[model samples]
Target: MLRIGVLVSGGGTNLQAIIDAISNGKITNAEIVTVVGSRPGIYALERAKLNNIPSIVISRKAFNSLEEHDTAVCEHMKYCDVDLIVMAGYLSIVGDKLINEFNNKIINIHPSLIPSFCGPGFYGLKVHEAALERGVKITGATVHIVNEVCDGGPILLQKAVEVKPGDTPEVLQKRVMEEAEWEILPKAIDLIANGKI
Candidate 1:
């Protein structure tokens, strides 16, 4: 089985989707072995606990530097024997140590279609807000390999969601999550876990 370590910062809707997908057999040959929260008291950690998965909290603020924080994360993943690292709404910008250690084993689910409203400073609701502001008719999600660059990795999967009239950023964000992020993230995981990628 492919051992996965999920990294999260806030509400873990994407993480929940992965758990559900695995539970329902939509994703075979993989299991979530560990969950690491960037901060304590996040709902993602609670989800991991409820699911009986091992979890840890490693806050960047507590570390002396970004490299130190990423080193701690990498060590924890190595300890867990994780084959893959999934960034599910993880807000922290990982440094080179973790990226180099994990290499192509890391994947991230971006809320937007990427290359449009993604990159540094584009995350969470801000992405949706930017999309709406740009008045794009189509907005979606992208699952891609995590590299040294932010959201600049090779794309694995993308699903487009239509931008409807009278849609606010919040509404579009929910739609994109439901229609795109939730669907493609698990599919990407399955693809990677099965060695189809």
Candidate 2:
């Protein structure tokens, strides 16, 4: 079984999806061992609690430097014996120590197709806004390897949702999020479970 660890920074919609998928046997040979959040007072922790999963809140505010924060987080992961790291809306720019330790064992789901609307400052609703502004007919999600750079990883899977004629960022995002991301994330997790990752 793959011992999975999830990192989140905000409301854990994706995290909930993964948990639901695992419970329903949509993904086999995997279990979430721990859930870590970069900050406190988010729905992610509550979700973990509801599911009876162990969770931790590592405050970056408590650490003076990025290296210190990374050390603290990685230490927790090591303690839990996590085999894989999944970034489910984790906001921090992961530093080198964690990347080096996990390497290709880490996976992240981006809100855009990547190599298009991805970078340090692009995330959440901004990605959808950019895609609509660019007049792209289709914009969706991509699950990829987590590299040192933000969203600059080799693609694993992508699913596109067509941009409707009268779509706003809000509408398009809701559609894509419902039709694409909810399924793609689980598919990515299954790939890892079956030695495809």
Candidate 3:
């Protein structure tokens, strides 16, 4: 079985989806070995606990530099013997140390269909707000490899959700997560674990 490690921040709704998918046998040939949160007291940690998965909190504020924080996180992953890394709403930017070590073994879930509202400065509700401001009728999610260049990694999967006429940023964010992000993130992990990607 592929030993997986999840990096998360905030509510970890995607992490919850992944745990549910694995339990339901939708995500095969892998098991979550650990859940690492950038900060403590986040719902992602709680989700990991509820599922009986091992978890740790590596405080971003504790380190004086981003590189230090990423090195510590990568150390934990190595100790856990994780074969794959998944970023399921992990907001912190990992440094080159982790990127070079994991290479194409890491994957991230972005809130929008790539090349649209993705890359530096586009995240959370801001991405949805941009799509709304631009009046894009279709907005969705993308799963991509975690290269050193932020969201510039090659795409693995994408599913579009139509933006309704009266949609607000919050509403669109919810719809996209439900219709796209939650579905594809786990599928992408399964694909990697099963050698489909």
lDDT of each: 0.94, 0.90, 0.93
The CA lDDT at 43 in model 1 is 96
Sorted on lDDT, highest at the top, how do the candidates line up?
A: 1, 3, 2
Question: On TM-score, who's better, 1 or 2?
Answer: 1
Q: Give the runs in model 2 whose Cα sits over 4 Å from its true position.
A: none
Off by over 4 Å in 1: none
Q: Single out the weakest 10-residue window by summed lDDT for candidate 1.
A: 111-120
Between candidates 2 and 3, the TM-score winner: 3
How many steric overlaps does candidate 1 have?
Answer: 0
Q: Give the TM-score of candidate 2.
A: 0.97
Model 1 TM-score relative to the real fold: 0.99
Once model 2 is optimally superposed onto the true structure by TM-score, how far is the C-alpha of residue 75 displaced, in angstroms? 0.9
How far residue 193's Cα lies from its native spot in candidate 1, in Å, is: 0.9
Measured by TM-score, how close is model 3 to the native structure? 0.98
User: How far is each candidate from the true structure, as Cα RMSD in Å?
Assistant: 0.6, 1.0, 0.7
Clashing pairs for predicted structure model 1, backbone only: none
lDDT of 3 by residue, 71-176 (tens): 9999999999999999999999988999899888899999898999988989899999999999999999999998989799999999999999999999999999
